[model samples]
Target: MAGKILISGGSGLIGTRLSEMLIDQGYEVAHLSRDPDKFSHYKTFRWDIQNSSIDENAITYADYIIHLAGAGLAEEKWTKERKREILRSRVDSTQLLLDGLRQHEHHVKGFVSASAIGIYGNSGDQLMSEESSYGEDFMAEVCKAWEAAVWQIKDLGIRTVILRTGIALSDKGGALPQMARPVKLMAGAPLGSGKQYMSWIHIDDLCRLYIRAIEDTTFAGVYNAVAPHPVTNQEFTEALAEAMHKPLVLPKVPSFALNLMLGEMSDVVLSGQRVSANKVLQTGFTFEYNYLDEALESFYKKHQN
Candidate 1:
């Protein structure tokens, strides 16, 4: 028998890919969206996260719920208002789902949600694991609250897994495309000091991790969803340039410039912390694209064709 799945943020990059992948794997998928007319594969329900009004039917018939709703961290400057939106987008959405699960008649077996490495902050040369201390930054606060909200579902006796994801690489709407754009134009440059470690994973691997979390009953707690090998910002740029068959000639973007342009959000660009996917791997999950260069090549080839 196929499992029934409910997904929030089904229209976003990771959510869309994960929904399609689940459907292909023979799961019945439903999506909760602010707008329901966008996709045909899944039943879309209206939900205002702030008001906590979710379609009751959407909550009543699921075996699993994957929450990936959030504002794009890099979509705008980290002004006071934008920061509130970012935090509210995640917390409110998760709260809505939790309320539905508590108030509605759903037999949800498990909960899977998206998290980030930003919670660890700038770790310099230190290696971060799931047990590492949370960073004292805006992103860290957001992640802390975001994860806390989802943790509420666990209290309801639902199996829960939080994916503390790293930068997801893909040609389909992510940091990769923006990075690729400059490289394809032969003007690619490393960002900041180029020493910041970028913990990254292929989009395919990320989607599979979520699937594994749902299918594998024993999987619970936090798992760092990153590739085995973490590369520095310089290495990422070079690999991207190589994949595009372009020369890396430009100097690195200065940290000060990024700070000036991005404001508080510059932390995302100028600083990075290395994260390990050891916990996820220990669960017997295998990565299809574990290396940075290999993943970039595959992505570039797909884009070209």
Candidate 2:
């Protein structure tokens, strides 16, 4: 269970923490970065997905590969060019990894990939599972293509696990800080309809699941990386406000305003997916922060102003 692991997007929020955890557990860890020299702390390999090139040594050096590279979906407006970048960043990079693995002779035992619940689209109230039908939205399309590319790695006879992750809540980065910022400023409110369900998982829980995927040979196919209980936007906002010792003095942010402000990318916040983590739980993967209040408190209680 302890061997060399190569992580794509190893500098990302999840990857950074996961790397530390893996290294602490006495596993050899290396990063597959676009600029290898930029990361001096670990052994780094280079891969240029746009040019469809990857270091052959990267493929050979790993007992397992964790794919987390992709363009940030919410980082920019969904311009035509940005949309293409989002799709290509995921699909092309995965295809490149797949191609490199095929061309090289290596003992890559497993492929653990990061996927999103966006595959289920704006699924309203129905709880989405691994068997849920896909959504027709743009994110859904991106996730479908991304997962398709990852599955092709299975053709190489490697165990492949894809976690259709929900909004990862971390205090260092990702969703929690942005959500807590407004609440701390006394302007916190739900986005779009306050009733929209927000399925979230604590970052530590998520990273642990990723580690489990690496160690557990029986883990295959897709599992939703979300908490057991998904709360509505209003409920989440209230919990966040309480955790941060702040007050919600503002009304819900209107959907039309978000659409105008964010363009088509607004769907990321306006729409909601009530994803289920039962599949992951059935595999005996327990969650540390399953409830919204505890998850929020874990991040905000000590630092609350």
Q: lDDT winner among the candidates?
A: 2
Question: Would you list the C-alpha lDDT of every candidate in the order shown?
Answer: 0.90, 0.92
TM per model? 0.97, 0.98
Task: Estimate, for each residue in 1-305, the C-alpha lDDT of model 1 and write its tens digit.
Answer: 56999998888899889988998999999888877867566788789887778888998878899999999987888889999999999999999999998998888899999999999988987899999999998999999999999999999999999999999987888899988888878778999999999999999899999999998899999999999999999999998888888898889888888788888888888788899878888888999998998898887777565
Instruction: State in Å the error of residue 62, model 1.
Output: 1.0
The predictions' CA RMSDs to the true structure, in order, are 1.2, 1.0
Q: Over all chains combined, what TM-score does candidate 1 have?
A: 0.97
- Displacement of residue 31 (Cα, Å) in model 1 is 0.6
lDDT of 2 by residue, 78-190 (tens): 99999999999999999999999999999999999999999999999999989999999999999999999999999989999998989999888887888888888899999
What total of clashing residue pairs does each candidate reach?
Answer: 0, 0
